[model samples]
Target: MLNNKRRFSLMTTNSHSSSQKVGTINGTKVNEMHAVEAPLSGAADEAFVTSLRGRFVEGRFVYRQIFAIRSYEIGPDKTATMETLMNFLQETALNHVTSSGIGGDGFGATREMSLRKLIWVVTRIQVQVQRYSRWGDEIEIDTWVDAAGKNGMRRDWIIRDHYTKEIITRATSTWVIMNRETRRLSKIPGEVKKELVPFYLNRIAVASEEKDCEKLDKLTDDETSERIRSGLAPRWNDMDANQHVNNVKYIGWILETVPIEVLEDFNMTSMTLEFRRECRQSNLLESITIPTTRVIGESNNSINRKPHLQYTHMLRLQDDRIDVVRARTEWHFKQKLQ
Candidate 1:
């Protein structure tokens, strides 16, 4: 039992969502795709679930899940939206936690936090996209946990085209535990520590360096080569379970200003976002994108260097111009799809 002083929150609510029938991705059954909030009968059940999603690769538990790009998941160009890729990554993480027995069930370490009124929040995340998966394309996301600070944990992913096995995107994220009642950051509880520590693997991360997530340039009118600003209003369905506009929805808004030529010939290679505030219903937001690079610099011999373009993005209140999120994206020209 955890002492009240050590326990961060006093939440004791126990609730479970009705399980929905598993749906298919590409003519394949994905039934059991929903979250498991109750513990499995025994270790044998756990092993079976783990094998279905992914397996242990040496020391790390690697989970593989497939996502088929639906029409709604694509942009006007008919390629997968950045938000869709992000959703797949987020779902994979949830699945990983549930299957690991660290989360799921109203009984484990993760629920223990909820039992104590604590919740996990993402502090930062960075993604590097090589190519956007097209509609009808099945993509495989391989996700694993990496060692983070004692109070937090890091997760990384490699997304690939399911059939071709070509890498499409790489992402990494950092998460911290927060008290729901006091709304303050908290250390990992002993229960969670014991459950998560053994799964931490010393492996090369997708977003390798700590500094990659640190600095996101603020958008300003002064610096620019090309720029676009679009008005954005969140729809009713854009809200998530938490009632605020979902984080992935912000990615779609940010990409609205990316040049059509870039979207057609090149691909978004890297993106970093610093979420400063949350937007609720009735917030009128402006999605602004400003290209920061002037030219694709040529090498010493005048040979063409890879086309590199950087754009700074901001989601701001249209009325007051208050910032909700600031992000930066890097793009690379692609010769052809692999």
Candidate 2:
């Protein structure tokens, strides 16, 4: 029997939402799981305040379960996962918070006096996964208020084991708050401010498989002069449940451009790419990458020169800006010579 328990939010006192009940039984898949409107764990305002205030001071939080990642977060392999690498970051951020004094609203609301009037809504979210968690691993999750930008704030979170405390997933999300009536970006109010200030992640870390890596700025080699040839067109095999080009399949597109000797020499080890848009099966795709020769920051690794270089690549359809729907990929490169 599958025992599914839902996390309760102190605010709203609403019941579990239908969206939270996704699960399978006897080989039968249930599309949309439903939950009742739960009650607020406490007064919405006070509870919200306590949640943020604590994070601001101590950086602690009661983990809540959101939706599961149906797909692996990492693009290349499943042996390594977003969960294990980021347990430290997510766990640390969620566990430190306190309501000491006055500052910006910690959770969602803004300080009308300290900042401006607004409610933070997650605007963008991105995740890279090396592996996916096996069934039965109930993930622990939490987040920190990342920032209060022009009219809203941002937060970051992660997923990990409830007991072992191993990270299984990592994520960063941007949030925005708008005026209650106008639906426009607004400043937070004063009472919502935290006496303590929020902090930023110094760097974006990727699970790398290469010895030396390069950045996008210097990685490119005369892309404007390149005339890439199309290999295979999309077939039914390339479509996913979403009825579009499967996300990981985009990595295969980039792999096509790499010389077979290069692909064979260095297996992918680590990568980072942004999905400015997605491609449908209808489009003929294009592969793009920053050449290794253009790489900087990394010193020559053993095996002559950087046994394997870390990499970042992207896949897109022709007229990418016009046709892209939701697409992005990251890949690591191994030096074949090594």
Candidate 3:
């Protein structure tokens, strides 16, 4: 096993080597570049390669990376979809763990966690989007972790435009350990805590917003103006390395019941998801949405005003009606983006 100091040194050495290759475009420095073209012969080489993708900052307590928006990641509006942004956040978090030398064979799991057959599971997440990135845009994302209450870990991210340094999105999430074999929640092992405690930072990515202050109300079938979409199942490709449907897939399903008009005319400015249970490939699911406030009509004057459309969403198993996830979303007119 590599000691913390040695691992950190390896990262810095690789980062300095990569920086020497950076070039300028039209007098502006181009910082984004591919990792070194070399064979991964051992763990040390693998760590060096991973450092090229992302690196630790702020005294090695925070991770920062830059990603360029691709064509496939954009929607009809020409801006990167919410799912793409979420994926970026997830990727950076995992890379942070790997670079820290605490990661094990399991995804983002510490060595002690892998020995105990434990994996991390996110319970809740909140994302606020002030702006969306367009195709060919380079966005920088920074992520850091801190303690959540006693047993839980809190991770937060800030996404910004690489050139202007303007904030685009902010997100925060809570995660806990679960036994991979038993599929039950587990407490943090002492050894795992010791490995992670030194890297924790007291930071807030999304401030001025309520943190679990108000509970999202459950939507029922009897509710008026409720929309339901049934007969949803996960594809084989939807499964992550953990042999279960990826959490990002749940966000797509939750929006299936939303009105097309809402999706087209408005941009989702904020979303909060509470994952209650896991979904598998064989399970059928149903999506339900209830409008919490009336959808605003489009008008010439609406462009200048900020009006929010709110909805509550639920995803449950088709047969047992067991809630898989519950969420609340807030949207504003697309004209606001302009």
Question: Best lDDT goes to which candidate?
Answer: 3
Off by over 4 Å in 1: 1-60, 76-78, 104-109, 181-183, 207-214, 220-231, 295-307, 334-338
Write candidate 3's Cα lDDT for 144-259 as tens digits: 99999889999999998977998888899999999999999999988999998999999998774444346876766587246898999899999998878898898899889989
191: Cα error in model 2, Å: 13
Task: Give Cα distance to truth, residue 298, candidate 2, Å.
Answer: 14
Off by over 4 Å in 3: 1-52, 208-212, 294-307, 336-338
- Better model by TM-score, 1 or 3? 3
Judged by whole-model lDDT over C-alpha atoms, candidate 3 comes out at: 0.82
Q: Which 10 consecutive positions of candidate 2 have the poorest summed lDDT?
A: 1-10
Q: What's the candidate order when arranged by decreasing lDDT?
A: 3, 1, 2
Write down the worst ten-residue block by lDDT for model 1. Answer: 1-10
- Where does candidate 3 have its weakest 10-residue lDDT segment? 4-13
Tens-place lDDT per residue, model 2, 79-172, is: 3233333333333433443222322443323244324444333334445433345443444455555444544454555556655766645555
- The per-prediction tally of clashing pairs is 2, 78, 0
Which residue pairs collide in model 3, if any?
none
CA lDDT scores, all candidates in order: 0.69, 0.42, 0.82
Cα lDDT of candidate 2 equals: 0.42
